[model samples]
Target: MRQIPLALLAPPTHRFDNFLPGANAEALAYLRGLSPGDPPVLLWGPTGSGKTHLLQALAEHWQAGGQRVAWYDADTPLPWELPAHESLLLLDDCQRFDAGQQHAAFALFVASAGQGYNIVATADVPAVDLDLREDLRTRLGWGPSFALEPLGEAEMRAVLRREADRRGLLLGDEVLGYLLTRFERNLKGLMTLLDRLDRFALASKRALTLPLLKAMLADEKIDSDPNL
Candidate 1:
């Protein structure tokens, strides 16, 4: 059997179509309809709520239309001056920004004000809970803010089923139920584990079953803990 290249096993691209918007329909619509000169948007949600995915999707949409866009993450050093002509700017993990970074962000915001540029940011908590300068916090809330709700169990199962279908794998309800009950419920982690299972199934020419899953977990545990 031919071995699959690691590069070819990259995760699926984040897009608007695949995002399961539960109670965030309004937020999704607002993001999709954004135009030049629209006020900035702040999306607040807990971990695994798809905030980063939504931001990436929005960036993809803008860039696909030939618009200049810049994406900044929490770990990236904040630029003193953002590109003045960029049409869209995305700042992720805003809650992690330090005071100096917040100052730089504020400067960038002011520079883009009234220039038909749009900014979208995400935070782990609501704007009121952010520990930033009062003025900066206030500006972050200048536009409409949306709280992304976590997907429920049914929605997660649906997501898993879709992912399995996309990969041309058959995931039974029993397996999915077991996974949900025994493993992490976050889509990111679940999908990662699913990818591993898919690879194992293909390589071993074995159907995905509870026994296979158990064996895989046992192997993983031994690999991680040699003393086991």
Candidate 2:
């Protein structure tokens, strides 16, 4: 059997309550306020931003109300028929779509419009700047679009502290600063790294500090190398 890479594993579930809106409160409100007959919505942001989180939250919101949702990504096949009073069509990672995905996404958009279903899409860039087909690009730029901003350092600290509390792990400001300054600034990746570091510390019966973190990373580097 082969082991799956961390990057390939499915991310944890996302919900509205778990999201830290920060400067994206308006965007959050917009998604939550969408109606069945509303025009399509596009959310763009850099990687590790909260675009995926919000999209999943919206899907969760609709699903909780018993509405049907059709979710499509670069790899997944779209549903042929939409069923239910309110249907939500979500297209994720639009910027990375192949030709087939772009075509299918455009068709989904048309069908969603015809059926008065709500459509929401996410991309790394705004539709006007997308590299997809011209028509599809135009269609994507048609509806309300919002740009998500990365969390500020202060906001990130709050999140780290909150999560640390939940995990019963104590992280000092110095250690947290070390992580924030050295890590890739995405909350998902940071959280995963934190989880790994916590486990390493527990197994070693050592305190979690900058030195401990460095040792854990060094150990992981050696473990991942077949020649080592």
Tens digits of per-residue lDDT for model 2 on 1-228? 223224333445688888899989999999888888898899999976799899999999999998888888877864334445558888899998888888888877776666778889999999999999998998889999999998988888888787777667799988898778777678877787888877777777778888888888897872322332
TM-score quality measure for candidate 1: 0.88
Best by TM-score: 1
- Model 2: pairs clashing at backbone N, Cα or C within 3 Å: none
Off by over 4 Å in 1: 1-5, 78-80, 222-228
Taking all chains together, the TM-score of candidate 2 against the true structure is: 0.85
* Cα lDDT, all candidates: 0.84, 0.82
By summed lDDT, the worst window of 10 consecutive residues in model 1 runs over: 219-228
Estimate, for each residue in 65-143, the C-alpha lDDT of model 1 and write its tens digit. Answer: 9998887766777565677585798888888888888888888789888888899999988788898888878888989
